[model samples]
Target chain A: MPDDTTPLGAPLTTPDGFVALYRREAELVLRFCTRRVLDAETGVDLCAETFAQAFRSRRSFRGATQAEARAWLLTIARRQVARYLKRGALDRRAREALGIVTPVLQEGEAEEIERLAGLAPLRAALAEELARLGGDQREALRLRVVEEQPYPEVARSLGVTEATARARVSRGLRTLAASLELRWEGERP
Target chain B: MRILDELEREIERVAHAAGEARPRRRWWRSGALLVLAPLLAGTVAVAATTGILSGEPVSSDPHAPRDPNAGIGVNAGPGKLLAVRAADPAGGPEWGLRLVKTSRGLGCLQVGRVVDGRLGRLGQDGAFGNDGKFHELGPEILETSSECQQPDGAGNVFFAMTSIGQPASADPASCAVRPRGEDKRPACPRGSLRDVFYGLLGPEAAAITYREGGKTVRQAVERPAGAYLVVRATDPDRRDVGWWSPSVTPSWVESIEFRDGTVCRPDERPRRHGRHECPLKGYVKPRLDIATRAELATPITVRVGTAREKPYPEMDRKSLERMEWQRRVTISFRARRAADARSFYKLTAEIPGRPPNCGVGLGSPIARDIAAGETVTETLWVAHRCSGTMTIRIGYEQQTAPSQMPFHGDGPPNAKVGTARVRIP
Candidate 1:
């Protein structure tokens, strides 16, 4: 992924050319925001607030190439993973305004970042259906099925995931709201 | 350490302390330019005993005539530099302005900021390095030039806009927002509002097309320059073309063809591309980039690859009514790769939204036409304001032959007309 001409001649708003573009896209934006929030301390806190908001807009990186500075640092780690799945938590204000700490994850580090981002077989097939849900309906299915796009733009625009379109729109709006009693909101969030 | 090497050593220590406090905001604006060169010679004689003589700021920058108090030597009046520099395609600094003629004879306009690319450095101290000259913003902005030297109001290029991401108040001016955590080293380099027009284009100005948010909101003037420095990034949540002041006249600039062939009316208002005329030799226009160069980190290549669509049964009252208003998504565009109608085209498709979307996503329809593999199917409604990646870009234009607008050097009006980046995912 470093080949298609990542030669990039300096001037990336120099800080030693954005530390060589933070060493070629900081582990590909730390396993792409740790496999989109399957968590590794929230993928090292959204790869340190996406390289501290790409080093505070490193003079707004307009690229000449290095695959446009790795698609401008994975579009700022895909908008810091869509603002951490629409704020379930972990924004850490541009990585605590550049103090940037958050590492300490060694020992099998979130199964080596979900096994080098294969995402440990989708976290072991969603860990037996998230251990038959309970722990507040699995943190209310990661805080109510993040809609209005971002579960990778509703799983790359519906070809699935916001947990299979929130499990088939909560089983097709719970069988059309149990024969039309209505009330379909957050399906028991 | 190792949050990517402590976020690459805290971004090379805050971009090496904002690239070394922008060259010592020149010993703090060279002591407010010797306490404002005796307060801009007593505010140019209290702005000629107060009639508020209309301002129009402009002063050029080849890397600035080595700033020994520049341009007719800091308002001893008589001036020059309408050469026009305008570079910031986000490489930062390069915005030349200067229309000076003052000492009260009137016609002043000195806007500065010109590091002249790759920050080889210019505007060395604050208020855009006055010791080098273009100054006139009154009361030396906390000792000037770490670049972007504004304030210069002798009056007239329509200033007064300071209320929303700072920078713009001058026309009988006096402004200061300076608040970035009370000085962590900032003399200049504070920016937000950037409409920046930068003048000097009338030697029969042969080609210019404006339009940064308008023509009922973006119709395509998408960077067709030859008219100096035309900046604009707006969208502090699109308050109808995000505050383009002076009673919203950019009228999307539309067109301005000149070089003795005359063209001006797409709705007119580039003040008719500098109005004078006649010297035509070696014409090389068409470089148009400002759409913040499609938010950098390029390459997507017309691939449909992801962003599929369908499924969002009332996606949470449309994501809380898109945090209160602005949501229009309709993109349909059926295909056609030309076999007829003399390959005519204006095939625009623009989704250009970045940062949870601010504006752009609904352009297609310049009566689509294409040749040598043509296809055109259109619908266009696109505002889906938020959610990260959106870059649509169908753009395939070609029109540049207004009699070859005088020897035109062409290239990049969306690269001769072919760019396809689909990202919405």
Candidate 2:
């Protein structure tokens, strides 16, 4: 991180900083991209593209804390994922010519980690429950839990207040838990 | 126990991964694109300009004159330059105004460069009366501020007396540059000095005039009301250059003082608490004319609406019905070709209100050109209690037309044009 005196300097060294950021937050970024793209390799590519963009624009980094940095990084990742959706694979070739690769999150390691954390079973049920909810509610839950952003920051990104952000997440969690209960009964119970 | 042990193992593994990812290099090279961007941009701009200059044809300036229209004895240099005190005053709070006498008796008044409040000049004779007079108009001592002079006094500096019959007060002690010279018109010293404190402050001043029976009086008035003098300079070629002060209501001016040797000063400052003569009625009517000649088949538009076409009836029926009343409104035309000559067209709208009328003045009426295959728009008002249908009879007369059919012609009068009536219900 830059010392207190330097207003213009980056918060941290470029390459190491981005790699550390990837290692710390890669799985969350992967899940975010997967939720939208529905393919493993595409998700990995999007995640990498997000990091590559973040690295190039490091001059604009303005994070006060690690949590803030994670929020900013996720915002960048979301933009990269949106561009990927807009242009598709043909755009990938154009982006490559521009020296931009839409990096993908490797599926195996992220899946294995989620399984070990006991979140693997929840993923499909959560996605279904989230899709059923209103747009704002689903966005709040994804940003707070899956992306691991703080409540106030998510509220700001969604143009809402902290209390509203927290309330949406809580309501989404309850609805999700009820949906999972029904799914479990329909399957193995 | 097995599940708990698995959770602990997973947490440990995650910790190990995160610790290993900690950065080893404190410094990393930034992307390659940034380093050579300036050099690449410079090369491109130079090449593009070179290409443009090598191939493009040189052309004369379109606005350049075919014939020189230079004025005799007029040098290309700044005329009648004033320093326009770009800095704020040093210490005092009193606002001031300054003016230079013109060859004509009335001079151009510059207000609001020195102080806060504003005052105005009598524009014409009898504007105040047959004999111009000033009265203690608005309220007294609205606010007080420090009046300052320049440490290195450069220009003519003066202060506003509180009223026509009051002692001129000095600005407060806190004002940085105190007036050190004699009370008479003081000269500001040259070069930088702290007597006026630090740098330039504000750019505002005021000039106020008042009449105290048997004497013409003037003062440099200032107010903390933070008033302004907005000067709009109009450059009408060499023939004319004029300035107009933004119109302000009389109630806004708070103080008045006469200059030295004017019969309107007292040893003591007086309270401002009286009314002055109200602005007079009737406006100065401007004279105008319309010129026409033999031309093409196209019709030209003229504004019959003149300054005399006041909304508040310019003439009563007794006065207007007997005399042929005419007014000239200003209009502009574009010349398409030298051969395609044009002439002025005249139109007037007549309507009757109460005989003795008082209303806001008439607005300017616009004119239009009649292009072939294009419709012309004209405005008309209905005269009351007479004809329910309004008929606008447009007529034209050419100086070159023969005695036969002097005013009217069958097919768009060659060397003459005449009017046609369009009925409005």
Candidate 3:
């Protein structure tokens, strides 16, 4: 088995390392495509294409962090979205030529796909609510939640104290929840 | 239930294939190259065939590269040419020049001049020979020169093109005089000219010069009756230009009367923002009235009265049947002789201080046309949850067209406008 404590500089050139990176990032990349395409079948195909391209370019990746790897995959996904917008459909002739078959979505998968499709409108509403917050609070919340940045880095970027950054993120989230009528199951009011 | 697992397996298969193939470049790159290469090659070939690559006079073949700058002059007006001159600074005699009047009431000028090496191609803004191509000059260039002479007669204007920075002289004798009492064509219609003026000055126009087809023509010919005229008024402080049509009345204008009460005509106000007050008398106003029911309620229960005492008589029964909970309230309103002369009134209602979904209900007729002195009543159902003095706003709108529903603009001011409070319980 490969060592669990791989060096930071180690590249994902081996099949095991590539698979590990894929398992960590594939669901997120798939969700990103599903939100844009709004169709489960096509989104799965796009997800497959994104991973295929990422694997082909794995030897060329120079990132030293998992965040960099995720960003690289997201960049590829965005380019795929641009191509889909321009052509109105992803070209699947190459996949067909390679004898690759897309997976059929089962009955229970429809609800998950529909929930993913609803994310776009929900995010739009959240953005409108976010715009009503103070500029610092909005920026802190965006960096911490939407961008998934660590609170310390968010604080450094916004030039605020770590506690202030946490406070802003907390207040911003509470306000957005109230305005959008959203409730987190495990969260206290 | 296992669709995600299936997708993961599929992705793994594709990724394994991709790893084995190890393609050096994206497939779409090659496809794009295959499509764009031919187009790029064709563009280069066309550029080389035209003298665009090497500066030379274009070939005379009809298919030969045509000068981008040269084209038939725009239609001005049907008028006899009075004069023609070359006005060359190199002391060369004038070349062949003739003006023909077209059947569509436009005067077309044709002139042929020798291409002299000293007079380089006329560049933009009177700048000489930046490029080999002859460029059209903007009208501002003509206004700066005092040597360029104007044509004579009541509505005669000169049109000419010369080398950059050179003024073309006009001779009155070279102009042919129209025979006395000959029927002359009326001036070019002002509708198209007014459109051009608006295009130049945009929405905030203070003043504009009436020029036709990028030429320095200042002639104002007679406009036929009922034709639109774009007039520029001058005062010591400022100048303004606006459109006026003698025959048609503007939709907003009620009427126009002269100070002497001699001429009274219905006029339509131009749809624009500017000083449009004309030198005329009083105007008429639009009349509108609206009436409505201020209070209403939802029917909660109906009495059916025992239905001949339910054959069993052992059980004491009530006479009333409780209906399902209803949230809708009926509202009726009438509009009379609305200021807007349009056919229909678009109606809408809203409950202030409530979420958009809270006011959702059915049965409001979208629009109804009420004739002059005739009243039209419309009922709409609205849903609201709040009780006690809920403010309900009813809007009556007159749109330019019947199809423009849910009118966006506020209807005529004071056209039966009022708000009322109603009990929701």
Candidate 4:
């Protein structure tokens, strides 16, 4: 921890601060990587790659607080996720170069990630939030977010213009984002 | 199972190696990164911090109030921060904002945030650095703060903002994160954690409402202070954030609902209270093809100079529609009269766009003392938002005093000896 007079955030210039950041945010990045691509093993690779990339460009980080750090990390992680989705597989260049190990998911680890991601309870809250939105919004969210379809496809499916489809999905997602505020502590059932 | 442990060691190795490779730079601050960060993430943090920076109006310490943290109000006689940290409408579980009241006659606004709260980081660095959330990390540990410089004590707005930043301390990557092997990783939520505007509305204020993202937003102030407005995004987060280059546009306030209510426009609490002319029906921001020329009263002449783009990183703008807007501009003044001696001269650009009251008004004028008949070129940035036959009229004046020797000093020289215009198509 920096002294009271020292700047607010972890300097990340030192090894300890950088590692502290990883120890702090690795799991969230793991979940982000795993849930987005829906694979535990790939999530592991992404987690490693994300940290490696972060370490490489640690100086590029300017946030003095952990919030800014995480936001910065998430941007990198999101790009990592985006890249993974864009390509068929994770780009292991960063991880491989760093000689980081990608752990195999134990038998139940995959299910654990699903649970950690809180997809079930999240679905419940989402359903509630979705139910509250207009039908057009809900369907638009379903096609764009759930199905992960492009705006054009969503628009065609909704028999609306692409712009209208984007509006619905955007509105739906925003309303649904409120669900993020909720803690998914429910059971597997 | 041991993924993070190894990664932790690896992180140490790399961070150490990289830290050694490049000595830590003292110049870099979180604000720079926040400016570079995505609109939602960086701007939200910045906007909140900026609100806080709009320091309270009162300057000159309040005659050593018995308790600085005592409950303060409008008539409290040069009051200070109240010893209160309630869950304001604008605040979350962590973030806090305080109005920069009149202290030493300087309105000091200090905005605070937990994670990406750049302003919060300032407090952390200042007297209130690292209260908590440093040792522990998860998705984020939020702590809100403020930093504001009121324009001649005009903008007396108060706001406390919040955002979900890093994760909790527990490493959810660990399979055994919870009792049932359940991992709760509060990863960065999809879609940026938007901003919430909350703070003490003045005692005299009633309610506030304004326009945001093509929608009219209203926030009614039931109490004297502590009313907030949560501005949520109306658009869906781009699913593929792998690569996105956004063209920033200057956001403006249309009309404000005041006098009837205590609240100010959502953009922020204003220095002046009155209905504004805004939200022009079917308003579309215009883009100007800026053309340049040098109309000067020589021994100074600008050659074929270049215009380089400067990143516009203003702190407030949650309402700006995502459009291709010129964020900042650095116009270069080049003149090589085959030098004799380099002297100092100032350059100023003025524009009167076709339609007035459009984009942001004239940016700060550039003041450079160029020695004529010298092979010299100087580049300075100016921020402007008028979109019509935009004219950049350059004029210069000689300076004798040392105070005006620096880049920004206003003396005489108010004639358009030369003019350059920009076109909006």
What does the lDDT read for residue A16 in candidate 1? 67
| Quality of model 2 by C-alpha lDDT | 0.33
The C-alpha stretches of model 3 lying farther than 4 A from their native spots are A1-11, A93-98, A116-189, B14-425
- Worst 10 contiguous positions by lDDT, candidate 3 chain B: B194-203
Model 1 lDDT on a 0 to 1 scale: 0.41
The Cα RMSD in angstroms, rounded to one decimal, for candidate 4 relative to the true structure is: 21.4
Which candidate comes out best when scored by DockQ? Answer: 4
* DockQ preference between candidates 1 and 2, better one: 1
Shift in Å, residue B31, candidate 3: 38
Where does model 2 sit among the CAPRI classes? Answer: incorrect
DockQ of each: 0.10, 0.01, 0.06, 0.11
Higher-ranked by DockQ: 3 or 4: 4
Tens digits of per-residue lDDT, candidate 3, B312-358, equal 23222321111112244444344443322222343333332212222
What are the Cα lDDT values of the candidates?
0.41, 0.33, 0.37, 0.41
Please tell me how candidate 3 rates in CAPRI terms.
incorrect
List chain B TM-scores, each candidate.
0.28, 0.20, 0.23, 0.29
Per-residue lDDT tens digits for candidate 4, residues B2-29, read: 5556556556644653343232111112
Tens digit per residue, CA lDDT, model 2, B1-425: 22223222322322232222211110101233245334433432111221211111111223331221110111122112122322323322222343332211111222222222222211112111111211111111111111211111122222211111011111111111112222122221221111111111112323333333455443343322212221211111211111011111122233322222222222232211111211111111222222244332344443434233323254344434433222332322332212101222333222211111100011111222234333345443222211221223233322121111111111221232223332222
Provide the lDDT at A86 for model 2. 34
RMSD of 1: 21.9
Alpha-carbon RMSD of each model: 21.9, 33.2, 28.3, 21.4
Look at candidate 3 and tell me the lDDT of residue B147: 15
- Which scores higher on lDDT, 1 or 3? 1
Query: Which window of 10 residues has the lowest lDDT sum in candidate 4 chain B?
Result: B241-250
